[model samples]
Target chain A: MNLNNIYELRWKVLPPLAGVAMIGMAALALVTAPTEVIEGDVQRLLYVHLPSALASYFAFSVTAVCSILFLLKRDFKWDSAAQGAAVVGLIFTLLTLITGSLWGKPIWGVYWQWDPRITTTLILFLIFSAYLIARKSSSLDSDKSARFCSIYAIIGFLDIPLIHMSVRWWRTLHPQPIIAKLNPALPDEMLLVTLFSVLAVILVAAWFITLGVETELLSQRLLKLRAIAKINISEKS
Target chain B: MSEIGFLFAGFAVFWAGMFTYLVILQVKIRNLQSQIDLLENIIENHDEV
Candidate 1:
């Protein structure tokens, strides 16, 4: 197979490669640290929620990339990729909420808290959901839907950094960016493991989005082919 | 009584969820491939006539 086949490319190779690395990082975390004095086993929630959230951001960023490409190239494949990533990003957003809530029960003493980070995350989720809805309104012309979805996708990407900065801009209890490279607070081991986890999930996200886009395109191709076949058979009869 | 244990469980669930999704996608792609193949065979047979 030629390099043009995504299956033959390096980026496509990342899922399995990163999967192994993630498992290794998990092992490192498992061995190096003692149980937290307070959150106990629950403290592990940090690793899950943070990485999931980061992966969600990464997915939306890819959506923006695809959306721009679709508009510039006028290629349907890029638009399909944007749609695929948006759906996956939305799922990861929900995961972030669930695991965050699970962690909150132990640390914040409440199952739900209206923290800055939490609120922005919720908004981000809603925006993407709306993006999907806009993509499939059924009444719009195909060209119109593609245009609107592309526009909405660009809007969604612009919202991500605003979501991140909201916690600092407002006096919220979400603890002001726990992980920044310039001035770090968490122990190096913990931070490294968490970063590794983020990278792992991002690879998983890319693999998923690529597969999804190809599947959707294949379905469309199938539908068109079948319709043509039916027409030809009826003409013969 | 460790922060790390919760940490471990979180990672476990996340990885498991992603892996399951990947497996599901694999199955779906296989199914679609079969459908496409069958359709193509029908079209080819019809053309032969």
Candidate 2:
């Protein structure tokens, strides 16, 4: 098939694939994974919590890379991609905060604390949220806006490393990285489910980014077409 | 609330957030698509003229 055909095929295929993977992951988390003795069923939240955090990291990483590419190439395509990834990253960050809060209420006995990890994550969310708003509200032209946002995104990405190392760098109520060690803290089945959850969340995040990029490109196209139509009308008159 | 309640709430919050974002993106995409279609028609007609 040609490139357009392949593109159309992906647009049609990805949504259902993401949906199925998510359902399968949920089943594994809820049914197949063993319950923790101490935390019991509440431990199941880790499946979604950890995966969403990782997915947000993935999305923001995409944004940061695309932002750099946009600066190097001065290509609007990279800017569009960076914008798409940022929006997806923001949504996932919001989900991480909310779910983490829910998970915290039970384990920590408080919905929120000034813990290092949580504080840094909240900062990440706020930075991206401001990035999106600034993209819309800026008085700059399109190219300048993209350049500004790209710089902002790269700077904002510095927070991810901080959030990742927060648990290690300082004493906090938050748990350290479970899967990052040579020997993971989770049992075999739980680890398997968590891995599957990460895969499913990443698939969904990819789908969202694709849709977001399409929307951004289409909007740009529409603006160009409108400008052309204005010229045509002015010439006719 | 109980442990089960928190578990359910966490999952519910996740699904709700994902679904809401998906809906918003879909709506925005649909609107842009329609606008593009309208502009394309205008440009094509102008070209024909």
Candidate 3:
């Protein structure tokens, strides 16, 4: 197919497909899950909450990567991707904070704590928020702001691994891995649903990133055309 | 059952927020696209004149 068709696939079809997959995965999580002795009704919701945060973290990482590329290539595309990723990532991060707090309130007896996971996640959120705010303060030139954010993104992503691996290295009530470990915490049925949710969330995150990036590029183009049109009018006058 | 209601509430609120944001973006695209079209028309009319 032609390039436009490919663009359509990335921008149009992908997000819906991801959304369908996410819903399907959520359904599977609900259907297959046996009630946890510990968290009761809220336990099953882990499928959505954990995956949303993971996807958000993943999106932010993508932003960082694109930001680094922006610094190197000085290309607006990278900046666009980074910007879009930051916005979507922030949404997911906020979800993480909300859902994590909700889960924590019942499970941990506290809405929030200075735990490693929470602390690192908060750092990640601040990093992206700072990047976005930095964008606003910069000259409206997309590329320059991108270069600035890219540097921040690269620095910001360093905390992601720390956020992820902190629980393993230290003793935390946040619990250990159901996967990514020598021993899995979850039973196969629960694990199965979690896996499905991860996949679904990942695809959805990818689709979101693609759309956000494309939209940024389109906005830049539109802005340029407007500026040029204004210039032409001024010359005519 | 109360907990279940809250869970559902969370989902509803989250998804609604996401949908609203996307709708706003969609509106922006429409506005930009129309401007681009207008610009193109003006350029074309200028050529014909």
Q: Each prediction's DockQ?
A: 0.47, 0.83, 0.45
Q: How accurately is candidate 2 docked according to DockQ?
A: 0.83
On lDDT, the stronger of 2 and 3 is 2
lDDT of 2 by residue, A187-221 (tens): 88888998999999999999998888887777777
Off by over 4 Å in 3: A1-8, A159-184, B47-49
Q: For residues A176-217, write the lDDT of model 3, one tens digit per residue.
A: 433222123887888888888888878877877776776777
What would you estimate as the lDDT of candidate 3?
A: 0.74
Model 1 Cα lDDT, one tens digit per residue, A1-237: 665686557454866787686676567556654455444657556666887898898888888998899889877778778888887898789889877876776566566766677888888899999998988664322766887799889977797678767754674444553422222356666777778767776776777777877676776567766887898789799
Off by over 4 Å in 2: A1-9, A139-141, A162-184
Model no. 3, DockQ = 0.45
Ranking by TM-score: 2, 3, 1
Which stretch of 10 consecutive residues in model 1 chain A shows the poorest summed lDDT? Answer: A175-184
Task: Compose the digit string of candidate 1's lDDT tens values, residues B1-49.
Answer: 2444445555666767777777877887788788888888888888898
The candidates score, on chain A by TM-score, as follows 0.81, 0.86, 0.84
Q: What is the interface RMSD of each candidate, in Å?
A: 2.5, 1.0, 1.9
Shift in Å, residue B32, candidate 3: 2.4
Stretches > 4 Å off in candidate 1: A1-7, A10-12, A34-39, A136-141, A161-184, B1-12
Q: Candidate 3 falls in which docking quality class? A: acceptable
Per-model lDDT: 0.74, 0.84, 0.74
